[model samples]
Target: MNQLQSLKKITTVVADTGDIKFIQKYQPKDATTNPTLILQAINLSCYQNLIISAIKYAKLKGGNHQKKIVNASEKISVLIGSEILKYIPGKISTEVDARLSFNKEECIKKANSIIKMYEEEGINRSKILIKLAATWECIAAAKELKKNNINCNLTLLFSFAQARACAEAKVFLISPFVGRIYDWYKSKNPNEIYSVKKDPGVLSVRKIYKYYKENNYKTIIMGASFRRIEQILALAGCDYLTISPVLLKELENSLGVVDQILNNEKKYYKNNQSLSESEFRWHHNQDAMAVEKLSEGIRKFAKDQENLERILSKNF
Candidate 1:
């Protein structure tokens, strides 16, 4: 079997893109889309009609251009999500506005609104996972949303505290970023201080995975934003991973054998200890790497989301 096929035996592979064509090719179990991916798709020639049709449909409903544009953007998002679900049997994760990351109530409200919109389009809630940032307020919002039977995918997770809180809340999944962690370390230390095997991103996800498994936390860890195939291979046994199509294709083309690299049987220092919020916070804070990456991830997502809104304004 190919590496992609071999990896699937141990982990659920998810395509993290708005490019439907790529998802069709890789045939991932599930798919995920962020504002940036959707915005990129909107600019592509193949998907231009999707945006145009959504805009026309919005105008037909009778509203000003701005309202029409907002409606169109939402429609495009929903359409892309629904189309992605056609190929993947598992759930599709659609993110809420990163701008609302810090507001608990607003985050909850937006998540519900997005869920409602999905429901209106005949997409069942069971097959939809709402994606949110892993801020303290967002975790609190996720707790309430879980109570309402809404599943969430906590993205932008860098610290163990964020993952711990999400797992404690019984979130459906948490996407601890991988590539961004590598970027932060590489940028700060231009010197070749780390090998691919010991890349900070790989180490960070392994720590989070070990903690989750040791504690029997049901919240699934889905490593996201990978920059290289090595990072993905290092996390072969993670519950799920959302990889970009380009990396997925590269993995498909590679010849090296892929095997399970992580599991509960592995020994870890934190294996015997349970983490509390205070301990989680202090430990994560001490890891200057995690602290810096988490902040950077949030800022990047917020900026991309703003750029998406600007794109909507121009053509809507």
Candidate 2:
């Protein structure tokens, strides 16, 4: 069997692209899209209809209301999410504006707004996962949203402190990026060679998995941002692994025996109960790689959102 087929026996695979073509082919249980992927897809000929429809819908009700135009952006966001949901048997994660990462109130407000938009289209709340950066404020916002039965997928997680806070907050899921962590370490040490199983990125997610399993935290750990196929194989039995189209194809074409690399039934690490805000900040600060990558990821997402707004501005 191909590795992708083998992987399904052990892990819940998720597509990490806004491109519906790939999601259709791989047929992941879940799919995730960000401003970067959506914006890129919007410009393609295949998705042009979605853009035009979103603009027309915006102009009709908006009547030049700036809020409505921005709602056009949100409208397109929901429309795309709805389209992806048709193909996804599981939940589709739609991210809130990254600019509100540090503002708990604003994050909660926007997440609710997005959820409301989805609900307006008759999409159930359970079918969606409101995504937010794993910042302290965002985690706080997610915690509050969970009370109302709204789930969340905390993105841009780098430090163990961030993961711990999400668990304590009782958030729905945490996506600890494997590729970014590996990239950070590889950049730091240019000469040393790394193995698949021993990869720093793989080890990071494994550490988080062991901690959560040992503590019996209910938050799902989805390994994401993988740079190599080896990294994905290294994390075989993780709760979920969000794979991009590029690597998804590679896995579908390659043949190998995939093992159950992670299992709560087998390994567990004793983790502390909870961390205060100060403690979270201090630990995050101490980790140089996490500090740099977390900031960089946020900046990139923010910039991509800004670019999407600029594109929407010209047409709508």
lDDT of 1 by residue, 27-114 (tens): 9999999888887888777677777777776777668876776677667777788878888899999888787888999889888877
How do the residues 6-116 of candidate 2 rate in per-residue lDDT, one tens digit apiece?
999999999999888898999999999888887887876777787888788778776565665677787788889999999989999998888888999999898898898
- Candidate 2 runs further than 4 Å off: 60-66, 266-272
TM-score of 1: 0.89
Who wins the TM-score comparison? 2
Off by over 4 Å in 1: 56-68, 266-285
Q: What is the TM-score of each candidate against the true structure?
A: 0.89, 0.96
Worst 10 residues of 2 by lDDT: 265-274
Alpha-carbon local distance difference test for all models: 0.83, 0.89
lDDT at position 250, candidate 2: 97
